[model samples]
Target: MNFPLHRSSAPLAHLTPALWRRANRHLLAKAIAEFSHELLLAPQAVSRGEGWALYRLETPQSEYRFPARRLALDHWLIDAARIERRVGDAPAEPDALAFIVECRDLLGLSQDVLPVYLDEISSTLYGAAFKLQRERLPAPALALADYQALESGMTEGHPVFVANNGRIGFSDRDYAAWAPECGKATPIIWLAATKRLAEFSHVDGLDHARLMREELGEGTVARFEAVLAAQGLDPADYWFLPVHPWQWHHRLAMAFAADLAEARLVFLGQSEDLYAPQQSVRTLYNLSRPDRRYVKTALSILNMGFMRGLSPYYMSGTPAINQWLHALIHNDATLCACGFDILREEAAIGYRQPYYEAALAGNGPHKKQLAALWRESPASRLGPGERLMTMAALLHIDADGLALLPSLIYASGLSTEAWLRRYLEAYLRPLLHCFYQYDLVFMPHGENLILILDRHMPARVLMKDIAEEIGLVDRANAPPGAMERIYTHVPDELRTLWLLTDVFDCFFRFLAAILHEQGHFPETLFWAEVAGCVQRYQADTPHLADKFARYDLFAPTFTRSCLNRLQLANNRQMVNLADPSQGLQFHGTLENPIARFRPGAA
Candidate 1:
């Protein structure tokens, strides 16, 4: 069997000997170092055999011996190159040289020209990574047209006929949007068919049709098989499919048993894809069973949260949901990591156009809303304080954040205000340290002092546009302190705007909307409270007040006056359900209980 070779610069031909030697030395040193770091054992005791590296580690957990193979090295090399490409430029330091060298070695290029190669790879990878992650291979031995038909049938409400060139043509009547009479037609059928195809292509050593009958009901399985028979196909030819739960429940069960059974002949609904080759058919079957409790538990572990719009109780009642949720969740992290690797590896190949197109295509209307919001409010407009507030707002809207919030709130039982205070305090206290360490100077209106004080008293002020504020702090302004102090604490990468755009802006907004829809007012209130705190901090800072007065920037309407206005608005909206737009105006002097004695309010 021929292993596919990745493309590299032609000049690599001249350096193949040197490259191999370098790779050997590098691999040996890397293996030893990894063994030492992970096992805490001397590298000398480690031994390498065909496709395996044996080493011993001392740990209370267990005496660990990791098995490493040459094949695994190949995979790792590919994965590392991909990661390096994704990360783009290496830090401009001697320590970063090893990373550059490793990337070069993977591509069979010399270290002398590594920087040039690295630049090429980074630009290429950044463009295509997101799209490639979504591409799924067709079931093995299934014709392209068949795959297209299968996918069309899954997504659209009708069975698709495949035309030449792998395009799926659906009758106008079958178009989901065009046909209204087919009330809530099962779309999962198509999803199931596609999954069956995927399994057939990817899995091994299984009777696909039998598994389908067992998983889907016998009647449905027979109909699916009949459809395949009519198409002049034998079921056994497709026996490599791996069963994924999403497809099985939504579409396969609804399809004719003949079609289902015939389709199953080529697919294995549940089996190892890339990992755990030794896993038995029975083990895979057990994991894929609709009744398995392990599915939700697995999903929670893998995705760092539960399925969206699904509850633990819901999972308990629905075996299909449970099974699919488990399969997806269990594979989530590994799939994510693999996708990242692919993006990195492919960067050098100059195929970013397709990747970017895929991302734009995949993101739905919700993402479109986020993109609009991002464009409407660029980070350049806000100062650090306001930017951080925006970040908080964005975080509140994130899907993962929203999904996990109810559980967290239920577990903590902290009132909305207290939760808001604690969360803001946790984020801001560290952020303040970052501000000081970065030596970011304040602007006019005492913004810096206000921000500092707000962090000190998180409950008092509200923070909006936090994302924008954080963006305003210049990298060069970072305090002259240990680099570790600045970089170590945050959960995700803080050095770039990608995290800001993707996680903070997009995902967070999604979370916030989900929470709002779910009637999780406490989460929203918590965000509002944080925003309020920030605003108050800016208002009360003595330096800010003095600067405003000295510069004649102070309006007759003071910071306290603004707070009073907001307080009145809140009370009118909450207590009497009064509209702020109505004739009743806040004179900024009403002694409402909520507004009274509130710092920075008159």
Candidate 2:
């Protein structure tokens, strides 16, 4: 196969030897740390010191040695500068690909999946190099940066996932033009789908026409309609939908060729409103109009273990769920007091291809194609002195080796514990109430939440990417059909894992490590503040005391629900979104960091 990804000279400019080497070093460090944390690779300590050690990982073919600080929650903080790779005593370069290949058997990378996983690793490195190529904003500068800047400045995509930025399907050109790190103002493609084949769902207050008027002003609407009229087609016969330009050219045009040819789907060209991709590649933020709804399209890229696609069948009840949750959460005094809220996915549209619909059994990339959703922006929700930053930025370490959380703390003029407490109140405490009181849980990972900051402290949080990500543990709490898909049948034992695994193990694990390493903050203090937040929430809500004991946040240890293991086991379709509880690959248990802070603990 003659490859064309690098045919354009400038597109692959970031892939210089120097940048590639640096990217390799960084990627390999992460892979080693994460792989070791998951217990996939056991590293032997060569020498040990207080709070740190020199560890060596040996494969049959290669031996790698690095000085690493073993932090709380079994996080290995590797010193990348000192990382050494060797082949029979001769010093070899530390390459992520080479490391993966060496540990292939240990990772259980099957014959079919090995190459694909390596391709993903290469893509991840490609993205890392691209980020390095740009003039990096250090954490201090980034602390004061705007919303989209913070989103773009996030060098590390997902903290835990080794192949975090593996946007595998995106070509070199696509990375330059459309990747989140590129910070390009991407104009989305507008396609009109025949009403017969398209599905549009919106909140009760806004109709399709009004939503159009609000989204695209009356002038743009008229212009689009005029284009439809010029072709002797009535604008009323079709529903105008926005699309990712890549999808329009590569997937939709080819996959739904018959529909396009038969006039069922008409390409109306690009829209005027420019958007910038958020941390989640599929979701785009309105650049021209900050208050405008975010347009998320069905992207067929294989990244972070899933072919990122939006199902039309799921779209039908999206608005209802959001509306329901908005009412339910806002009405709840505890959640509202915590300054917690969600950005509703107010409107959604999905173009159903008849042939694919008939042939496909369930949700996949095929049936999920040609769909879009408009999410409520946090811009309008921000108070006078408040601004927005992705919660992911908290764990962000810029190219200059500065963590944004410390910079944010310094900028906020608050003590580390005070800042930590405020954050927990805005984020973790609200999540605890949701789980303990309402039996609700979201995929409360970093990217899923947008922190509304007052100066540099997170005064409140505006949670986005809802509807699809959220789950109701108690199916009874949902309004019958509203949460049919959102209902998670996690056993009573594993329900605490939502807080323990997702929050503590996945998110706070990295956050704690970053705080401890970047700033002089102690790990025990971080957990103490977290514990205090939970204690206060519990104290305030005495009625939920029984519920709290049942799903104990202060449990000694919780099941280690591993992210890398899930992706390593199956890069594609890591977990079925519909029944996510079924696919959890639990190797062992993690000592809950907050267990010491439990009431009456020694």
Candidate 3:
């Protein structure tokens, strides 16, 4: 089988000024819409007609007007073409950087944060331009595409956050070689580490040698061991770890110089199997053999609010968390009935540098610099005639202005309403059960989930990014020990906001808007379908009626926990997952779209 890998001499061919202007216009539109939703920049209503409205936002340096339709959850669906930017009565081109600089005070960006935030916005625009040039697949063709295609084809990063693809540390060459949107096949770098300094953990049925033998083939493992044996070192005392090639050259080479000099960390070269990075950036999928488990490595790059590194101390108990959660999900009839399952993190290995370990306080970048985890691939979970697609693709609109969601819905050969019903059941039903029945909540945003499409209709969904992202609202029920770190205590009034903000606002707000614009699917119909999913789930399980009422999904309003606000406040460490509600910036509340769909609502 021929892999779709290529080399290009002209990586920056996409950076034409024409594309730059177009990218900035699109980005400015996004900034306006998202910032408006967060209430950082209030756009006064200028006029209203039909469903859309004209609004004007006055900043100190500029007055901007854009046509936007206010959708459910205060979503400002702005039209990029009609947006007008003026500087003291003279029309000016809309540039995202200039817009940010002009509205820095309005955005509550401090003197230091403003410059760094602008850098992020620039990197995001750079990625957007690259995508505009190369991501050529139309939504209709993408409707029948495979999993990796859908993953890379996704144009929007995190739907709610404007500075989503700000890979701050990556250079232009690194972007070409490593960015998921580049669709390049990269080989994972393997390193042999002494067991004394490194920790290897896995589920019951697996061990280090077996994992190595399976992952790097027996021949390569033997070759690696022979290198160790040649150096007068015992291969038995060491464990093999997979790492991102970029991290090896960038962070490990210099930071872990002591380990390299002491022969504690031996770089064992690249593997024969090539892996393509997923949207999350750090996690890579094996293109050489699709059935192989994914390799998630620590990357020091600051992206989307945090330095993307896996904490060795925190990751040690990942397999245990997965083992517990997998059993819990399987034991329940409802989760199984919905065909919901998770891609388990089967094994993990983390190296602790003594110097950094002693010097660094708390879970800083130095402490989290060298670690990796292997998660089960969704390929093995596919049944006959089923294919995998990232839930993010549902919100993707290609450069041609064609949307993939409508394409998939149409390709399913079901009416819009019927297709949405199947989708809600596959993706949303299990989430409801997890919250109401078990008091569990996951960061079930689009990228954290995979949808199994049986000919374009979502059959079931697989949730990943586990162990780190999932939390138990009932903190008392958390498994004692390091695993208990997943405990997140939300106030009783704010429990439902987890679902409302994570699933509804973060994901569905954009999804409903796309459907309305691309497919003419009414926003009311979408919310109604969502309401039906919850009603059916509750009706089936009357035992959880009290819990459902207490944490009502159909509540009139929920706190607007802003994603960009967290990033704006501090991109380095956005929100402490251990204490999630702390330092949260909630301006006000958003009216829940499903409130009107309640049985007894006015």
Index of the highest-lDDT prediction = 3
In order, what lDDT does every prediction score? 0.26, 0.87, 0.89
- Candidate 3's C-alpha runs over 4 A off are none
Steric clashes per prediction? 88, 0, 0
Q: Top model by TM-score, which number?
A: 3
lDDT of 1 by residue, 1-602 (tens): 12111122231232343334333233333332322222222422278765345544322222323343322101111111111112233322111234334423322344443444343223222211211222222321111112112222111110000000111111222222111111111111111233322222101222345444443557656655565567676544432222223324332344324444544322322321111100000011121232311111110000001111111121112222222222432354422221111000000000011223356654221111101000011222333443212112111211111232343334345654565465544443333222323322111111111111122222222222111122223435333322111212221212221222222222333333334444356334533564454444445444444432332211222111111122212211212111112322222221111222344545
Q: Which TM-score value belongs to model 3?
A: 0.98
Alpha-carbon shift of residue 205 in model 3 (angstroms) = 0.6
Q: Output the better candidate (2/3) by TM-score.
A: 3
Segments in model 1 whose C-alpha atoms lie over 4 Å from true places: 1-211, 227-233, 239-414, 417-498, 509-602
The parts of candidate 2 lying over 4 Å away from their true place are: 1-9
Encode model 3's per-residue lDDT on 328-416: one tens digit a residue: 99999999999999999999989999998888788788888899999998998888999999998888888877888898988899999
State the displacement of the C-alpha of residue 491, model 3, in Å, after optimal TM-score superposition.
1.1
Tell me how far the alpha carbon of residue 292 in candidate 2 is from the true structure, in angstroms, after superposition: 1.0
CA shift of 400, model 2, Å: 1.9
